[model samples]
Target: MKELKHLNKYFKKYWFKLLIGVLITIIARIFSLIMPSYVNKSIQAVEEFMADTISLSEAKGMLLQYILVIVGAALLSALFTFLMRQTIINVSRYIEYDLKNEVFDHYQLLSLNFYKKNRIGDLMNRISEDINQVRMYAGPAIMYGIQTLTLFVCLVPLMFIKAPTLAAYTLLPLPILSVLIYQISKVIHKRSTKVQEFLSTLSTFTQESFSGISVIKAYGIEPRINAELRVLANQGKDTSMSLAKVNAWFFPLMILLIGISNIFVVYIGGRQYINGDIESIGVIAEFILYVNMLTWPVAIVGWLTSIIQTAEASQKRINEFLKAEPSIKNEVLQPTVIHGDIEFKNVTFTYEDTDITALKDISFKVKAGQTVAILGKTGSGKSTILDLVARLYDVTSGEVLIDGVPVQKLNLNSLRNSIGAVPQDAFLFSDTIENNIRFGNENASHDEIVAVAKKAVVHKNIEGFAKKYDTILGERGITLSGGQKQRVSIARALLKNPQIYLFDDCLSAVDTETEEEILNNLKKVSESKTTLIVSHRVSSAKNADKIIVLDNGKIIQEGSHQELNAVDGYYKELYLNQLSGKE
Candidate 1:
């Protein structure tokens, strides 16, 4: 219940709708109460007729009136019960939507470090499975809790007013029932939390397996995957069954206690009637109906508690992420203009998770319209330089500046929107080729998409397909070849037409001839944009205005390509090696 307090704002938002539902539940219960009173009256009428206190015709008339009133009251009760669902359940759905959106929005605001700390499937579980449990508390549990309280408040006083002694006997088992439910509810809460945790584990395993299905098949490891799934499935089933076993105790216990209550009513009432303490048998019948009326609300007590405990556990998980502060905060809300004059002065960065320093006293600058090529061996910090400029990872010690202003001081959205980056992996979405390209520019026309595709030298390849740009790609653009995916990703960035361009080995997948053509096209489009090219090939850097060579997270060589070619350095040796290979 403490964890569930997180949803108080949502409760306040829909308080009016819940208030209406409460009034309806009360009115419906009152209407339902009319029947028992009428049942007593109808029985009394028969007794009067048997004792000859009234004419048979008059008794028949009274019975008919009572029957009509009873039926009308029952119908009114049924109608209001329907309205109760419309109000309370619908509010639950509204709250669910708001909660899901809130979690998702928070997820987007979190930094890359947070994603590194968490799993995709676990994140997905919190938004979907965890929120669903909380919704049950918002809707059905609250509705039934109100109904139960209403019955107890309205029914208890009337039961005593009718027959205090009988009421006393009938409610004797309730205290014991309450104590049992409290003990059982504690167990239920513990088990519920375990079930939720296991579900998340199962989800993560399934998602990872599906994403790596190709790798598993390539290695002929289907049996190994199946064995791992079996282990996860067994654990999941055991947790779920443990929860079910405890839940199984609730309904049977309720029924048994209710049956004891029924026994008390009949046995006590009969004794009273026989001992002349009661006026008529009709009183006995009315008390029986009263006890019966209490049966459902009482039985639902255990169920309502179960739902509440489960919701509390789930909401606790949801609250954990909601309370997390993003590592990177937006210092400026108002938009700031970006001209792409990027600079990093005395920058150093260490990966927090692995504690590996990706950059060591790194420093570089690119003017508003200059092409810089960074050449390095794998793990030599070339990508880290581009990442620092893009502000993906903040520098551990030093400054990242754009147009002489600190990068952190600038508006995050404005800065990101100004830069177009094609990542090392060239990721794309599972959507139409046109839609994937349009992700960079949502309002881009079909002609603009085609134009960028041609600039990236992928237009003819796309046009060769039957659907051209309309072809649907599989997850992560799996439907396309590695080279085609890289080309499409390049086209997406070109479509953004940002002030700063980052090509992170985007040409590695394509052949040398195609890479040359794409580079020629990029040179045209990036004429006045600050562009950083990270690559292993000497050809990619041979024509740049400046070439930087890095080794082990430190810049070892920096000069023009021709200048470096003349010097005795790694750059010269690499150029000669590639040139000899070309011959």
Candidate 2:
């Protein structure tokens, strides 16, 4: 209930409709209860006519009036019942929609490390299956609960008012049912929670298997995968069956208790009538109808308890993430723009998950409109530098300054909006070619997309596809070749035309000739913009304004390409090896 307080704001928005639904529910139950009383009066009129206390036509007239009133009450009851669902159940749907959007928006604001620690399948299950369980509480459980309460309030008093002794006997078994429900409810709560957890685990396993199906097939591990899935399936089956066994106990126990109540009404009420304590057999018939009225609401008590327990379990999971504060907070209260002057001042960054320091006291500077290239081996912290400039992660010990302001002091959205970064791995959505490229600049025209694609040396490949720019890509853009995917990512970055361009080894997949063409095109287009390129190839950095080489996490060399190549150091050795291979 404490976690579910998050929905109080949503409930306030629909309070009027909920209030109306409650009023309608009371009216509907009142009309339905009228029928049992009239049924008794109609029987009394028939008996008076048989005893010659009234004319046949007079008795017939009384009976007809009673029957007509009973039918009219039933009709009104059904009509209001329909209106009750419209107001109450519809509010639940509206709340469900609002909750999903709230969760998804929070997911977007979280820092990158949050994604690294969580599985996509677990995230998907919480948003989807878990919310569905909560919706069951919001809609059906609440609706039926109101119906049950209304029935009990109206039916109980009427039964006792007609005959107090018979009413007491009929309700004798009810206390036992309440005790049974309490004991069963405790076990149901424990089982329902376990079922929800297992669902998340199963969803995570299935999602991972589908995403990595290519790897499974390539390694010929189909048999292994199948065997593992069978184990999971069996476990899921057993877990569900355990829950089903508890739920299966609900209806039978309710019906057996209801049967006992009915026997008490008929057997006990008949003796009272024979002994002249009661006036008519019609009274006995009315009691039977009252007992039947209690049937459905009582049956649903167990089902409703199960729903509330399941909803509470799911809300606990949702609240865990909803309450999580983002590690990265925007320090700037107002909008701030960048002029693309970037500097790393003795920055040291260690990954929290692996406890590996990716950068150690690394210092570098690139003035506005200057091009700097970083050359390094794998794990040399090149990509980490680009991520810092993009502010994906904050520095551990030092400041990353942008346009003479500490990166944290700048407006987070404004700072990110000013930079275009192409990561080492080119990830494209399962969308059309035009749509994927337009992701960087949604309003870019067709000619603008074509222009950037030409600059990245991928226009010719797009022309060869049957649908050209309209061609749909497979997952992660597997439909394109490795080089084509990299170029498309470059085109996307180019389309943004940001003040700062961070291209992290984005041209590595292209042939040297193609790479040379793209570089010349980049030089022409990026004349007055800050550019940082991370690459292993010497040719990619040969014509830069400045070059910085990293070994392990610290910078080993920094100078112009000509100056570095002239010396006998790490840069010169790499240049000689690459030049020999080209020759």
Candidate 3:
């Protein structure tokens, strides 16, 4: 229940409608109560007229009045019921809309690490299933629960006023029934939580299998994957069946108790009639009507219990996501603009759960508009450096500064927007090629995009397509070849025209001839921009103003190509290896 406190804002917004709904429901219940009394009074009127207790004309008038009262009550009851439904339905919709929008806004505020840890399916469940469950509580469950309570409380007093003994007999089983409902509700809450968890697992499996269908097919393991899916499906089915079994037993037990109470009422009321304590058959008939009305309210207890428990479970899951704090957060007061000059001063970093440092007390500086090349083997922290510079993750020790100001003192959005990055595995959305390029600069003109594409050496390949720039790329750019995708990604980064450009092995997919052409273009474009290129190939790094060699997360050598070739170290070994392979 504490977890659901966040929903109070939505409740406050729709409280007027909710109040109207409850008021209409109460009016409807009161009008409905009048019908049984009118029926009883009309019966008594006829009996008295037959016994010569009233004049014939007077009896006729009395019967006519009772009939009109009954009809009017029925009409009022119908009208109030309609009003109740209309108001509550609107409240439910508004609350659902508000909750969903809040969830979406929260998602936007979350850091990248949150997405990396949580699955897309689980997040979808929070926005969809969890929100719908809350709607159930706001809509039918809330309206019905309030109506039932009012009906019981209002009618019970009326019963006592009409005939105290009959009222006592009818309500005899209520306390015991209430205790039973409370106990069953606890069990339902626990079981329903388990059911929701199983459903989340099933959704996760389905989303993963569908998203990775290409990988599954390429591995030729569809049968194995199908078997795993079957297992998850069976688990979900078993959980649902178990919940059904609980519901099956719960409802019948409640009905049985209500039935026993009804039997007791008939037995006790019949004896009172025989003893001449009760007046006419009309009073006993009205008592039966009241008992029938009481049955419906008791029946809804089981349903309301289920709705409340499911709402609580959903609230808990949603709150867990909302409470998660990002590892990299903006400082209390951060700078807005960052100069291109960057210095890494003995920075050391390791991941949260690992002892092995990814970057070991490294130190380097790149002047504003200089091109620096990082030559390293795999797992040599090339990507980690880019991640740190972008502030995707903070350093464990030392400092990384931009324009002599610590990066931690800079605003995250302003800093990140000033740099362009092309990672190792470049990804493009399933959208038009023009749109993909425009992701780098949303307001970039068509001419600018074309210019950058030509510089990346992919414009000719794109023009070969039927739709050219308008052609829709497949998911992750599956429609394009590896080299084409790499070039398109490079063009997107170039469109941004940022102060810094970070290329992490972006040319690995293109052939040496194409790579050389792209490098020549980059040399001209990178003249006044700070550029850092991470490459495994010796040919790519040979022409840089400075080359830094890294191995096992440490810089082993640094100098010009000619200066490094003069030394007998890792750089010379790498150069000799490349020459030998080419021969």
Candidate 4:
């Protein structure tokens, strides 16, 4: 409900239209009520004239007036219907725009941990399906509810005027109907909530399966994946059927109550006509018209109840997401420009739901414009250091500082924009090469992009493609080879020309010759910027200003490659192995 209050802005924008629509609807209902009275008066006039109790000329005049009234009421109804539809539909569109913008903004502000915890498909469902449910209630349900209330107010007065006794009898079943609607609505709300949850689970499963289809096929586990998918599909179907069942029972029960009310109107009004207590056939006929008007309003009670319940469930989910607090938030003050000097001081970090520390009591410093190589065995927290430096996650204890300012105090955008990273598994969108490069520098010139691609040694390979820079890569760059994709990613990062660069095994996919070319390019680029390279190859770390060896989340040795090779330790052992392999 608190999340729904955010819609007040849209409400303010459309308030006048809604007011006009409601006013018109009330006027229309009032005019419609007059038609029944006219029918009764016209019939009584004709009968009196035929019985010679009134003159024919007077009856003719009365008939003309009644005909005009009926035509005017029909016109009013049509006009109000148009106005209500136009206003409510536009309101729905405005609310949709607001909800989408809010969701997108929230996504951007959320921490990396949030993304790690929630699946992409689940987020999509919140933005699409859940938002649509809210729109349905806001627009059509609210509009119809207003229409019903107007009809009830206008028709009840007329009913009392025509035959107060019959009107009183007709209302007897309404309280029972109200209780039934309330109970059914509660059930619908509970079931609809479950349905939305199941839909999210189904969407998550579908997205995961499709994204990992390559792995599934490679491992020959398609049958296992399919079975898992079937389970999720059945769960979704069960929840949907449960909701449909609630509607099925609720609608019929509503109709039965309405039918009984209609029958009572006919039975009691007929006796009044026979006993002469009611004046004429016209009176009974008008009473029936009023009763017919009551029918839709009664039916609408069920529809409105269901709509509100569904909307409430959707709002609850949306509210939970909106209320989620990001683990990382911006600093109160903007930080000064960074000079790329980074230090890790007695830092310790452990991921959520884990006991082992990823990095413990780690201390290191890299000066500006120096190349540092982090040599480590797998799972030695090399990549975790880069992630921490980028503030993807906060340290569990101690501090990481950038240019003398604590990383937490620095402006997040300024901190991240100052660093460029090429990860182990490089990813690209299904877009042109030019567009992908432009992601690093949106306004980069074609020549500038080509220059950076040359530095990454990828330009020649790109030129071999039919469309070259304009070629659209397949989804996740699947159309390109692993080395080509990695080089493209490198080219993109190089284009940024950041103060600090991180290469996390980015050259692993390239051949020895291509890897040497990229390393040569990096050697030239590293002269005026801070660079950190995480690699397993001894040859790659040989030229670094400083090389640090890590094992089991702790640094085992730190020195130049020649100095580490001088010692009979892990570095020397690695060098011997590589040299022996070459021999």
Candidate 5:
């Protein structure tokens, strides 16, 4: 119930549609209630004619009028029901559209650490399936719940006026049903949450398996993965069946309770007529019909209850994320293009919930339009340095500044847009080569894309393809070789024409000769931009204006290639090892 409060905005936003739907539903119920009275009248008219208390012609006219009223009521009920569905269901769809958009927008605002903490499939489930569950509550469950309430309001009073004793006897058992349903609701909500969680797990397993299908095939571990999937599939099925059992039992129990009420109506109403307390059999028959009207809505309570329980579970899950505030806030004095004089001052960063610091008092400065290279062992905080500059993760202590403005104070969009970074993984979308290259700058001309590709040394490879630049790559550019993917990624960054460039070991995939060629090409473009290159090979950083050596999350050495070669240290050792390997 508390979780449902999150939907207040949507309710207020589309109140008109909700109001119209409710009004139509009430009208439809009124029309439906009216038909049963005509049923009573038609029965009495037949009784009067058979008793010869009324003339046949008069009786025929009355019966014909009753039939017309019945027909009219049925038609009006159907029309309003259609109108109610049109308004309410469409409003639910609109709400869904808005909610999904909001969630996606929040995802964009969230930092890289948030994504690192949450799985892709779980987020996808929230956007797709969980939101859909909430949709049921917004639309069909709400509509039918209103219809049931209207029936209860309008029909209950009519029953009491017609025969108070009959109403009392039949309706008294209803409180017990409500109590029973209230108790069952707790179990239903619990099981529904379990089902949703298991479904998320199933989705995650499927998504991960597909994403890593190549690895599975290469290792010939398809059988093992399939077996694991079966376990998850079975768990999902078992949980669903558990929920289905609750539904199966709860609905029939509602029908059984309603059936008992009907029995009470027939038995008690029959005796009241026989005792001459009631004047006519039609009264009893009318009460019976009114009770029948209550049956479907009452029986459907179980189903509606199930929908509500599922929605509550889903809303809780979604609201938890919606309520989360992104740790990184985009703040700015004034939005401006960065000149990219980056400085990390006494920076120390520990990831969420970990005592181990990834970066410890790391300090460095890169002048505007200068090339700085970083060499480090694996897990020596080389990539962490790049991530900090982009504000993907904030520093635990000290500050990262760009052109005298703290990165945190700069507008996130302005800060990120000014820098071009090519990560080690070289992720690319499943799109044409030209489109992938133009990802950083969609307005880039075909000529510009080809030029960048040539500069990255991937243009010749693209030209060799059957569709050339138009050729669509596989997911994450799987169709491209490792070197080709890296080069394409480099081309993407080049097209941005950013003020700063960060290359995180992006040339590791290419041969030494090709890497040198691309580096030389990059050197020309980076001459007017601040550039930071993280690399393992001394050859990669040898030509840089300055090279910084890192060890255990701290800078151990900082100097030019000539000075570092003269010093007896990690840099000199790394250079000798690479030189020896080449020989």
Candidate 6:
């Protein structure tokens, strides 16, 4: 219910449409209920003829009128059913669209830490399966629910009027049915949640296996991977079977209750007629018709309850996602544009659940139009510093300032929009090469795309493809080599033409010769914008205007290439080791 309440934003927009739909549904159900009265009238007319109160021809005429009334009611019921589906069910679709869009929008606002902790498959499940479950509640569940409720509202009093004692006896099983539904609904909710969770696990496994299929093939471990996949699939199947078992037990009990109620009506009404307490067979026929009318609507309770419970579970998951507070929130006032003057004032950052700080009391400043290279070993804080600059993560202590304003206080979109970042692992969608390069700037011309590709030293390789820029890539751009992916990512960043640029070991996959060539081409691109490069190779950092050497999360040296090369420290040691390896 809380999850449904959270959807009030969408409800507000479509409430009027839903109101009109409900009215139509109620009118339709009323027409259907009135047809049972026609049955009563027809029987009454026949009874009158048998008692010599009416001629056979007159009774036949009355029966004919009731037959036409039944036909009209049936036709009107079908028409409103169509109208309600068009209105309410269509509204559910619109709301689903709105809900999915909002969830995606909120996901974009969340900090990188959130993605680091959450799986892509789990998020995908919430978007797809969970949202669809919510839609069922909105559409078919609510539609039938209203129809069933309307029948009770219209038919119950009429059932009493036809024969109060019979009505009371027939309804005797309902309170027990209510209790059974309440208890079974709890089990359904719990089992449905487990099934959904297992489904998400299966989704995660499938996504991971497909994404890593190349590695599995290269390692010749398909059997091992398949075995692992089977484990997850089996778990998913077992949970689903468990849910089905509960449903299996509940449905029969529901059918039994319906049968028991009907049995009571027939027995009690038959006895009353024989004992001469009732008027005639026509009255008993009307009472039986009313009970039959009540049957399906009451039976539908089991189905509607299941839908509602599933929705409740799905909504709980969706609400957890929606209610998650983004670690980063942009609440700054009139934040000035970033001119790429970045500073870290004794910044310290420790990742969640880690005792040691990733970046310890780090302080540095890069002026506009400067290229600063950070050189470090495997676990050094080079990438952490760049992460702070992009505000992918805020500093755990101290401050990061861009153009004199605190990075935290700056507008998030404006801040991120100002920077272009290329990470070590280049990820691209399955799309045309042209589209991948144009991802940073969708409005970029073909000429502009080719220009950036050439600058990143990837144009020649792209031209070698069968369709050149139009060549479609596989998942994660896996059709391309590692070096090609890196070059494409670099070209994507180059196309952005941002105020600041960050390259975190993006040249690692390329050969040193190709790396040098790409670096030489980027000299012009790096001239006016602030640029930060995190690399382990001396070739990548040797020509930088400034170099910062880091070790164990602390800056060990800071100077130009020659200045650091002349020093007797970690930088000098790294230079000597690489130079000797070359010789």
- Judge candidate 4 at residue 152 and give its lDDT: 81
lDDT of each: 0.90, 0.89, 0.86, 0.84, 0.89, 0.87
Point out where model 5 deviates above 4 Å. Answer: 300-306
Model 4 lDDT, residue 498, Cα: 91
**Candidate 5 on 1-583: residue-level lDDT in tens?**
7898888899999998899999999999999998878888888898899999999999999999999999998999999999999999989999899889988898888877788888888999998899999999989988999999999999999888888999998887676676576567768878888988887888888889889999999999999998998888888889989878876667666777878888898899889989987667787778778877887676557667878888988988898888878988887757877998999999998888556687889888999999999999998889989999988888899999999878988888898899999999999899999999999899999999999999999999999999999999998899999999999999999999999999999999999999989999999999999999999988889999999999889999999999999989999999999999989
Per-residue accuracy of model 3 over 1-583 as CA lDDT, tens digit each? 7877888888888888888898998998889999889888988998899899999999999999999999999999999999988998779888889888878888877776678778888898888888888888879888899889998789899989977887887888766676677677777778778877776777888888887888999999999998998888888888888777777776677677777777866777788878877777688788888887887687677668778778978988988887877777777355487669989999998876455688899999999998888988888888888889888888999899888888888887888889999988989999999999999999999999999999999999999999999999987898999899999999999999999999989999998889999999998998998888999988888888889888888998988899999999988899999989978
TM-score of each: 0.97, 0.96, 0.88, 0.91, 0.93, 0.93
Better of 1 and 6 by TM-score: 1
- Candidate 4, residues 54-169, lDDT tens digits: the string is 78788898889888888887788777677768877677777888888888899888887788788998898999999999898778887878878988877787678768898888
lDDT of 3 at 539: 83
Off by over 4 Å in 6: 47-57, 274-280, 333-335, 580-583
1-583, model 1: which lDDT tens digit per residue?
A: 8999888999999999999988998888889999998999999999999999989999999999999999999999999999999999999999999999999999999888899999998999999999999999999998888888988998899989988898999988876776677678778888889988988988998899899989999999999989999998888888989988988887788778878888898899889989988777888888878877887787677667878988988898899999999878889999989997888789888988889998899788888989999998899989988887888888899899999999899999999999999998989898999999999899999999999999999999999989988999999888999999999999999999999999999899999999999999999999999999999999888888899999999999998998999989899999999989978
TM-score winner: 1
Q: In model 3, which runs have C-alpha deviations exceeding 4 angstroms?
A: 42-79, 82-86, 101-120, 264-267, 270-280, 332-335, 445-448, 460-475, 579-583
The sequence of per-residue lDDT tens digits that candidate 2 reaches over residues 362-392 is: 9989999999999999999999999999999
lDDT leaderboard ranking: 1, 2, 5, 6, 3, 4
Q: What is the lDDT of residue 55 in candidate 5?
A: 97
Is candidate 4 or 5 superior in TM-score?
5
Stretches of candidate 1 off by over 4 Å are none
Q: Which TM-score value belongs to model 6?
A: 0.93
Candidate 3: worst-modelled 10 consecutive residues by lDDT: 330-339
Estimate candidate 6's RMSD in Å.
2.3
The clash numbers for all candidates, in the given order, read 0, 0, 0, 0, 0, 0
